[model samples]
Each structure stands twice: as C-alpha cells, then as structure tokens.
Target: MSIKIQDLPNRAAFDVKSAQDLRTQFAKDPQQGLKAAAQQFETMFLQMVMKSMRDSVPQDGLLNSEQSRFYTGLLDQQMAQNLATSGKGVGFARLIEQQLGRTVTSPGELSAPAEAANTAGNALPLSTSDGRHLQYRTVLNNLPTSASYGAPAAAPAASNGDVPATSKDFVNRVWPHAVEASRSTGIPPQFLVAHSALESGWGKNELRRADGSSSHNLFGIKAGKNWSGQTVEATTTEYVDGKPQQVVERFRAYASYEEGFRDYANLLRGNSRYSDVIGSQDGTEFARRLQQAGYATDPMYADKLSRIINGPTLRQALIG
Candidate 1:
C-alpha cells in the first residue's frame, strides 16, 4: 500500500513519499485523473532523466539514424506516460530549479546532473540537494573508518590478451572490473570506462541521492531486484538493444566499493546476453561481436564503441 503524501509529517517542498500515492493515482487509477496527474509530474521526471540523457542522448540535431528514432520514441511515448501517471512533474521540476537556481528548459538539459549522480560514494565535486556545486566531503564522511566489516575488494586487472601492467593505479583499480565487464558483457573496458567516466566522472559524480542519503551505486546501476542496500527513487533509462526505451526505476546503493565492483562485474558475467564475450580472447573482435550481437539499441552502437575506444580520451584512460 502506498502511503499518503499528507500522512508524512515533514517533506521537502516537492517530495512524493509513497508508492501508494502513485498507485492510488496511477498504478491503478482512472484515465482522466491519470492524464491530469501526468500533466503535473511529466516535467519533473523529465528533469531527472534529462540529467543522464544530456550526454548520452546524441545531439546530431537530426533523427535520421535508428538510434535517434529509438531515443525519441522513448522520450515522446514512454517518458511522457510516466509524467501523467506520477502527477508531480511541475512540482519536482520547480524544486530542482529552485535548488539549482536555473530553469531546466528541456529534459535533455539535465545530463550534467544525472551523470554527476554516479560517483556518490567517492570524493567528487558536485551539487547539493539545494543545488550548489561543492566538494565530495559527504562521500569521505560516509566511508567506514576501518575495514572491520570486510577486506577491500579489488577486481582483477584487465589483460589485453597480453601482459597487463599495473603502473597507473587509478586505471588499474577499475580495469579488473572493466576487463571482467568487457569479457562478460562484450562491452570493451575502454568503452565501459568512457561510459563510466561519462556517467560518474571517474568517481566524482552523484555524491548522494536527491533524498540526502548515501547511494552506494557505481555506474549508476539502478536496483532491479534482490537489492539489499541504500536506495534512491529516480527516473532512468532502460535500454533495449542499446536504444533508450525510457524506464523510471528505484536504484540500489552500496556502502563499500567492493560491493559495487563485485555486483557490476557479476552482472555481466551472469547475464547470458553478454556471454559471447566471455573468454573470447580478442579485444577488437570482442567489440565487433558485441555490436553484431545487438548489444546496444543503436544499429551503429558497435561503431560508436569502436570510435570511443579509438578516441584519444578513452585510449589514454585505458592504457594509462
């Protein structure tokens, strides 16, 4: 049962507390009412999702490509439905604008903030709930003073089917996980890092959730099921064949880096869609196969990944 918003004593200016509130409103509600509610919340959720899409959503300004078709399809059809059903779009957007002190013109404009949401656990410069850019002091405070609970987990280093060097500790820490991700998901390590860096700013983004809590999520991977960690209710994308299909989900969080690293690594290893890359023994071939296998929504996703890997920034992030 969803709790009534009024039942909650003190809520931030634009907070909606219970699924029941949404359910009573939309999970199962009358058509007219749902439409009205969606009108109100549509803008707000768009604000949330736009934060991520601003960067990820291609802006060639023309939707000639299949990727653009899928992207727009999600925005116009899928996301708009959520706004009507949730019934808090205006209020939420208003709150964000108030805190950030800038009006969000379109959902796409929110990419910076969404990307910033990825590295909430580690030190990263970001905006506060009230919308002020600041250091990641909150992250430092959330970490355990001692590793009494468990040992620090380090993912295995990624070998390019050759001798894997360990000179660059920064890249080394994530490469193991990346290599595993590449091997399991067929998403190349550089592609994953570039995406992660774009998503979380190399552990300097998403210091916390909108609710003022530690969200222990890396890669901004949302909670799907069997999640037993901190959570943030937010709108995110659901990709089908690498195309955005628009999904608003509750994301799970972690308390330690080990948990996040392990979960991400395993996510790829376990999912069968990514099984082809498992121990394939070729980097470029792995990338090509992933694309051919329809790993992303875009018909040209493999091409994009190739370009990203071959790009200067991604190459440096990988080898350095």
Candidate 2:
C-alpha cells in the first residue's frame, strides 16, 4: 500500500516510435483502413494495461507521504519542483497520482492575479522603489519578507495538465499529466479542459460510485464489454451527428485522471479515425476532428466544446 518515490515504476516514456512507424506505414498506403484501426487497437491495448494496473493496486484510501509517486519532468522543471511536494505537474501529476492510488482532488479552479495589479496602476512600484525585486507572478517566493505580499503574486494559470498554477489558493487540482498530454501528445490543453468540464461536470458527476471508491475514470468514458478495466454504471450522453443522445451505459473508469487523459491522447493520436485531427493542435481543429473521426456522436459537440473553451469563464481560469 506504501510506495516510495524511488520504488514506483517509471512509465512516462511514450513509445511513439512504433506510432511513428505506424504513421509512416499508414502514409504509404493511405488507402487501407488499417491506419485508424491500428490507432484504436493500440489505444485499447494501453487502456487495458492501465486498467490492469488499477485493478492490481490496492488502496485503503490512505496516501503515504513517503510512498509517493515521483513525476519526471519532461516539460517544465519548476512544475516538477512544485510537484515534488504536491505531487504533480500541470497535467501529469493527476495521472501519476491516480496510478499511485489517488484521485483528482479538485477541478475547475484557476485565477487571474495580474488584473488586480492592473487595477492598482503602478502601485508603490509594486513595492520597493528600486524595482529590482520585481518578479513575474509565476515564480513568486513564499518568503515572509514584505516583498512576497500586496503585489499580485505569480498567478500561474496552469502548471501541468489543463490546470494552471496561476492561482495562489489550491481549491481544485488537475491531473497534471494533462500538460504532458497536451504538450507531448499535441492535444491542446484547452480542449482537454473543455472535455473534462463537459464530461464529468468538472469532477462533480458520477465519476465515483457514491462512495470514495475509484471509478478509475475522471472523464466518465464509457466501457465496452471487451475492455478489461473496471466499470462504473452511469447515465451518459452519446453524441449522434452533433446532437447529444442520451444513453446510460457502463463507462470505463480510470484509476487516475492522468491515465484517462493519457489514454484519450493516445486514442486520438494513434487512431486513424482521428487522422484528420492529427497535427492540428488548434482547439477548434481538435474539436472538428473529434466529430469527424466519430469520437463524439453529437451534432453540435464540436461547437459546444469549442464555445466552452473560447468562453470567458474557462479562459479566465486558464490564464493568470
């Protein structure tokens, strides 16, 4: 039940080489349906593996301090540094924590600190007339010195995952791996945020089983019988031709949000159904491709998703 940071297995290395080769192979023919199918198969395989890991790990709902899951920094080092204590980056920490037997603590939390300063208008040279100590809010030190306060502290909107670190108060936490998923997998963070918001109602849905049990899913992704992962029964909406058709199905729950996000990225990146979506990191493009690739059955799914992302509420949460 206890896992030290050093003892946990490192699974961050994404084997994109085979994916690259598969992409090349898909390009050679471009005619065969093999490309799309290959992607889904690989994604399914990955999901199954994560499912296995989730099932194998036992949780008494106690996260040991010494038994922590260390997040490797493939992106930002400071985020990695912060994660060393809180245990995650913008996107990955959530995933890593889930694998280590924890669930996302919060969702839909972010803030903009600069506006307060802008509203203040050159106040006290932001404290200290020398202006020598003026630092960006993203890296504000928590020292007791007068320099740490009254000024808009570094309001990092998102550090890892789709969640930003701009907000000082830790109300909601993200998967942290969402950043890795967005940056490394090129899924675009906003899109991921939009999906998360829509899927689990910002982590306020039936993601859990009424008890504090692991649904193994943060996004409320439905489960197919063939899927080996544990399942949670929930009322879900199925998108059909851009319209949300109602469907109550058994959804696949991730042991952690990070795993869910990672699997979602792999599913898109590896599947040919999402080929129209590949290399297009734009949130809108990503949305369009999701519909085109048949990921969502809703007719207005893309529009709804893109609108939410472009809206002021989500945008405000994203930036500091």
TM-score of each: 0.36, 0.46
- Which lDDT values do the candidates have, in the order given? 0.42, 0.43
* Model 2 clash tally, residue pairs: 51
For model 2, the superposed segments whose C-alpha errors exceed 4 Å read 1-172, 210-216, 239-245
Q: lDDT score of model 2?
A: 0.43
List, residue by residue over 1-320, the lDDT tens digit for candidate 2: 32222321231222323223322322332212132222222333343344456447664456722123211112222222333323332443333323322111112211244234434432211222233222222112111101001122234334544433432211123423454465556544456666777665554553666565657465555676668877777767776554676777887767766687777777767767776665443456567667777766777878987787657655454432
The segments of candidate 1 whose C-alpha lies over 4 angstroms from its true place after superposition are 1-192, 198-208, 211-216, 238-247, 280-300, 318-320
lDDT of 1 by residue, 186-305 (tens): 343545554444445444453357865546455567666776767777655456755677766687777754466567667657777756654432234455666565444456646655
lDDT, candidate 1, at 236: 54
